[model samples]
Target: MTSLVVPPSTLGSSFFSWFASSSSNNSLNPPKIFRKTPSNAVALYPISLKSSNRPSFDRFPRTKIWATLGEKDPNGAAPLQVVEESSSSIVDEEVEKSVKVLKDAAKTRRVAAEEVLSALSVLEKAKLDPSKFFNTLGGTSSPGRTWMLIFTAEKKLEKGRYFPLTAIQRFDAAGKRIENGVFLGPIGSLTFEGRMSWKNRILAFIFERIRIKFGPLEPLEISLGKKDEREPSSKDPFFIWFYVDEELAVARGRSGGTAFWCRCRRVNT
Candidate 1:
């Protein structure tokens, strides 16, 4: 999971912290599905989570409409009561339309911050099926997809900004691998690579190694932990997906911050 956080350094922009080496990353149960890839098949980076504060939302009250009974029964039974429709049903329809607008605007990055935020809020409350989200995001079978970070919403969703740096995340569902990288163009880059476990709506991962390259210096590889380390579970830092389509995806990190990524071609570096 690529969770945006404010780093200790003065980069003036937030960078995802690498998956930390902690007990939370461990899981007693092995992943339900597993695949093996070459040890050196990837050069990835890690992202640590920083829990952000979010405001609470209120649920809409449901309005009930009683159905009228039009039968004159000899037994004199009470008329049956029925609910015509639920308030959520109505909201769901509107939410679907709003999501379409979001997907359309994401293509050109022309959507206003306010509009994007509003759409995201609606998605959060939309209660869309998680199974569909997972299937479309990572794929049904061999999930191999890349997404480019577009916008990040701050605490309380009061402020929003476009990502200043180039950050990309790769999910290999078949191989159970995840790679997150931030490129500095000609300056340098940071990458974290490791195993990922996908369950329901969450994608959990534990980065095992980090690669750093600065300027003319040779890239350095630092092992974060032993290969036999436990797999990450839901208790670990993760992203709860709200919406996913071919064009874009919206998710909220464990840190409470919300972000949306647009599907992009894989980055080979």
Candidate 2:
């Protein structure tokens, strides 16, 4: 039910008195007021004039409205510090997950090629700091020095295949030494030992000696013996490391080929 109450101040005492007198002399009915409710039904209110010629209104229930304050507000913007912290956390988690997948693929070699490629892409896009790589890959620690090539991707990174031959690489951060070897079961083996320089994510190396063995013959060593004493630079054959952990590593060579390696037992030259 709805009603409209007119104030005494709006309708003066003289008007109220005149209306009361006219109502007493003749029967009069006040207009009915209608209000539309939520159910679409019309509610009517009957108006009655009291002896004092005053009007009254019936009270209806009020709809309660509530508002929540503080950071939980959906319409509010998040603080910059919180946003940045969350974003960095997500990036770290993605890098960690990708690294795990890559390591698993390297060890088991059972993961699908497409999935491995995707994981490699994720790590490369992460662009994580190279400091850990330098220490863990070249530092003189249990898993630091030796790694065996497991898979290689072409320059376009569209397809990858496992190396048909056994190949291993070693790095010594303290001495900045690099060594590479290829074994052919008992048939023969070839080894290249060299000096390397590390700059950021790239490890540039130049071989100084070559060791070759065939059949049962003794291994022969030969030195290129370059007179230059300069250190290897970016101009030399280099590898740009994308990720390196205790178990696995992924890097791109100067020839634009990408490869993943598994940590292997260290061997002496």
Candidate 3:
């Protein structure tokens, strides 16, 4: 036999060709390779081969995998999850704050209503005292004029006090001091007579029957009584009537063809 000697170049080329052919065939039926080196024992490695045009390893280690998956920066997928949680927490806090504000406002309104009721109670109590009562009368017109008739109860009693129990005062249309006097005890009745002039007689007629309301106390109904022909008057006749409360507490005195028509009430302090 001829002496067989393997050249280094031929051995290297043959190893490469065998590797390629084995790789191509191994694509359909993948092979398990076992290599024994001088220092290491048997090392088993699995090599998956694809088409020759493709990369040697079917799937290679991906570069910067975590970065590509958005996991390394503040704006990454994990950071987005944290942001969503934080945003939800903030919205919940705001909702709770708004609820608290509404509750506080409702409580304040209730307290205010209670305070108003307390004030009204005090005012109502003050109105019950007869001694604290005072009456004021006034009238107004264009180029307006106003008159005030005040009546205050006396603190002490004396001899002359019983004789003239009440007092009376008169004011002119100009609101200037015209007359002031006292009603004698034997006078029996008092009367205030006047005429209301208007460009339209119909207005005066309607106004003559108007009613004055006093908050839950009573209503004073004004009506025409009799026409006094003797007194020279304008087209609007002298409308006469007695003022009285619904409860009839301060009623007009009816005796000796005389009637007391003025009505009075206690004022709330």
Candidate 4:
């Protein structure tokens, strides 16, 4: 066996040859070296790799960073969220004020209604009679005057002295003069006895009927008696008459008769 000694250069060359062949056969395809692309895919051109042409990554603007974090400008400090909050606060205040105003108005209306009810109750309790308080007088004959009178009275400060009675007049359907005077007094007591006539017996009839219904006259009275020419004795003649003790004061006459009636009562408190 001859001694085979390896030289350093020859051994090194042999190891490098073996290493180069093994690497060529076993290594992957150099990891597919890829070129760097621009951050924005829509950019017209890729960014340059030169240090001078590339973006200054080390000197990034602080403003850009703050903008990404949703920073507002110092001069125009109001953000959308802050503005919305302020607007919402104002709207809430207005709504609250409107509600308060409506509540106050409702309270006032309720108080007014209560006062009206109280006044009406007082009027109903008084039991005032319309027939006794109002005096009827004459009116125009051509239009056939007729009136329905309403009287309202209120108690005044002095005892036995009452406020003036309020009066309203409603005319009849036939345009007849139903009421002549609307002042306070008995039929014959007024200075002017309105244009009363025997022809319009319906007027007198209505007055007597209303008095009987509302006045406290006892037994009632009929003054004007039968005017039917065919049956001079028939009691159904057309004329206003006072009824007292269920008897007629004026017997059957062709014309003028007392058409007044009254019921006496003590003044109420």
Best candidate (score: lDDT):
1
lDDT of 3 by residue, 99-126 (tens): 2322232222222333323322222222
Better of 2 and 4 by lDDT: 2
TM-score of each: 0.66, 0.66, 0.16, 0.14
| lDDT: worst 10-residue window of model 2 | 11-20
TM-score, ranked from best to worst: 2, 1, 3, 4
Q: What is the per-residue lDDT of model 2 for residues 6-92, given as tens digits with 9 covering 90 to 100? A: 111111110101111111231111112111111111111111111121111122323333345445434465433122122555566
What CA root-mean-square deviation does each model show from the true structure? 11.7, 40.8, 55.1, 56.1
Please state the error at residue 226 of candidate 4 in Å.
27
Looking at candidate 3, the ten consecutive residues that score lowest on lDDT are 10-19
| Model 2 whole-model lDDT (C-alpha atoms) | 0.56
* Candidate 2, superposed: residue stretches over 4 Å from native: 1-85, 141-144, 267-269
Winner on TM-score between 2 and 4 is: 2
Clashing pairs in 3: none
- lDDT (Cα, tens digit) per residue for candidate 1, span 113-221: 8887887888777766666565466654544776666677765677765554455676776677777776554456677888878777787877788888765578888
